[model samples]
Target: MSIKITKMIAKTHCYIGQNHPNYVIIHETDNWAKGANSRAHATAMKNGNLDGTVHYYVDSQECYQTLEHQDGAWAVGDGKGKYGITNKNSINIEICVNPESNYYVAVDRAAQLAAMLLNQYGWDTSHLKRHYDASRKHCPRRILDEGLWDNFVKCTKSYMKKGTNAGSVKPVKEEEPAKLYRVRKTWADSKSQIGAYAYLDNAKIACPAGYSVYDWTGKNVYTNTTAKTGTQATKLKGLTPADLIKKIGPLFTADQLKTGVLASVSMAQFILESGWGKSGLTQKANNAFGMKQNLSGNTWPGSKWDGKSVVSMRTGEQKKNGEHYTITANFRRYPCIEDSIGDHSAYLAGAKNGNALRYAGLKGCKDYKKAATIIKNGGYATDINYVNQLCRIIEQYKLTDYDVKAGNTGTDSKPAATTPTSTTTQKKTFKVKVTANDLRIRKGPGTDYAFTGKYTGKGRFTIVEEKGGWGRLKSGAGWICLTVNCVTRV
Candidate 1:
């Protein structure tokens, strides 16, 4: 069966970022209807009606490539990835099992398609896995239920032995792994660091008193579970969902008191984006609210960070058609959950889409529903069900109690923290695209002030407060030379 390449016209649900297609996952489309076939399924995905998407659909008559192998599929997430098989490092192929189709012939065609992928990776039948292997769901149900899995593997090996489709597919280069599991107390306070490890288990073992294991992104992944007690010292992976709330809830409340962004809405975002604080980004960067290290080098005012403390990772973004793609950007690294909450609130309170605040009405919004709607309308997220999801989370968690009457009521009102009773001349703010990586940051405006020992990284940064010849960083790290050769006002 020749493969008909029918790529998704727009980005689809098939986004998990770039991966090395080392293993091929076999699945059987459980649809037993007569007309269901490779082309039909591919068209369904292209039209955005499929329940989830896989890379290829194989039938007896034809093999249709629905999604790219480089991007991940939404195929095998049921098991929470306990078996080392993840959507990020595998390829997915679904064999059609419509009642009128020849299921056996379709299985054979799937075997050939698997052979082509294996050839690309220089792999063999052992690397071929089932949806059952990753998620333990009864996928490829017919094959498992009827004792056909063994025969399918044997058929794939036979095709491999014959070298029948060696050069049909291109070789895939492996993505570079994340930098390292650098264990530290906090990314900002690196002097308290002890050791770094390549493996997470080893890092956990080496973590000592008042210290934690951090990934390349500066997330607090592991702490010495035996040495201390409660939320902060507990082993991270072992914490239940309720325990995660215990860890992050207080941080959001503290930030709300200072900025008046709804704690309920922000906490709801934290719940959804970080999978209730169990996602790797939360584990790696401590940004549970899905605060992306955005493409623009934005370090919002009131954020206690320099541009250097960021996790370079892949995050999913979408087009207007709801098609998704992955891009690598910097997510800010937080020393603590409080820092993440503070930075997120600052972003919501100050980030601008031209002259207007992106989530302008979020601050002091007493109504959770209105706050969530404002977030959705501001293009803060692309999910169609974003507002609904946030509302559900808020009500389910009794999160509205966290809201304080600090000013906003869903109108064009400022938070109590910023509601100026008297008018003062606002300083002009602008962006400076720093061309040099070593621009000296100072304690005061002039060159006479002591050095703060921070460098402005090469990126566009917001200059909020200015002195005679220096610009204070919006991040509150320090001030940089405004008239330097490297600093160009954008």
Candidate 2:
């Protein structure tokens, strides 16, 4: 069956039609608000609200063509810079998803669209690419997170062979859920690194030192298990040197604390770099550790920035000749120490700095020494003694003792207890359609409340309550204003 294309009106400047597309660049809408689907995205494109233009939006039911394939869309941010070839000669397709949409269906439709476009242009699966391959902003996050990008390409290839009626072209089957395995450096080590895989051979290949595999129900499956798998018998059984634990200990998130990045190593790095938070950057700008400005030149949507706030300082750089010299460089300024800590984590996690490929093996590394070694080898610092210095600080402070075993709780470990509070107020339920772009949903009924989320373009939502012209969403995310002419009752 031929894919239905709903053409959207667009500004003449939105795209250039002379350049024929040679590749298909894939992206995700990234909007998590309810009902933000292909039609909604089409509306946003027609209204001239989208920051950039894409050729098509593929949803579960239909594909909306916002720009012609012969034209160059501004989806990739290179803008005549690096990867400009794709931007000048590629078709961009955005797969839409939201709380109300079926993401798998959308992805399947996107695969079909990609295959059709490839066939039409006489191209191949080699022409497929994620938005990240062009500019590295981590677009199509769901596909990447689930390790489905390769499968997507394979499905597209299958579709190309089978023609438009390629619904039977199945993606690669997902691997069976593997037993969770924990590995530690020593029995005395308080924390262990966790990984999941199906086969014992794969688990053994991961270097089985102080390792134990657990079943789906969190029961140890290893015949001769020595590794601890459950909650600690005693809380804070081993304590780090109280004097060595810096004031920044509480800044780490629970997930970060358990991320196999030894708290001791991170703390020592912070103390050594920031001089116990007494540096000029720390005192003036709350930048406890020196992190350079993002050199990628890509603006991620949710990242924090004031645009004008920055600090320049001289730092040591090691040359290929093994000589160190001081050079001035600009560093990021943070509003709080928390942001600095988060940025540091992101730096090591390869979220910033555009060097994710360099530090690919650092995540969930239980051994602090190995982590240090990886960081050093990943070119995190020019200092040849970086790993040694970090290890020395960790050993001196006994920081590994402070590391706690991660709980066996699933994805959302901290489940909140649901207790009904006293409430006699009545609420009427009604359906409403969002009529505005970028509508903010606040925690309360007023603008003064903190924004919980946002809706891009137009969408439909169920209002369960109304107070002073503010409507509370049935999803319980937050409240939106009904008084603002941006929403109408359905």
| Local distance difference test values of all predictions, in order | 0.66, 0.60
Model 1 C-alpha lDDT per residue in residues 111-137, reported as the tens digit of each score: 778877887789978899988778766
* TM-score, candidate number 2: 0.41
The true-structure Cα RMSD of candidate 2 reads 18.3
Residue 335 of candidate 1: its Cα lDDT?
Answer: 62
User: CA shift at 377, candidate 2, in angstroms?
Assistant: 7.3
Off by over 4 Å in 2: 9-11, 77-81, 84-86, 165-490
- For every model shown, the clashing-pair count is 4, 0
* Per-residue accuracy of model 2 over 1-490 as CA lDDT, tens digit each: 3456777857654556665677789999988778788889888887888877788887655567888666777788563447644567788899887765557657867877888888877888888888866775556766754444655776677667767542333332235322233333332342443333323433334323345555445555563344533222121112222422423343342425545455556766775565445444554455656777754444433244455556655444556554444344567767666666656666566543463446567767768899888777876776666676677556654555444336633354322322212112238898887644546678975444556656534779989986534678898789876533344567
Candidate 1: residue 285 lDDT (0-100):
58
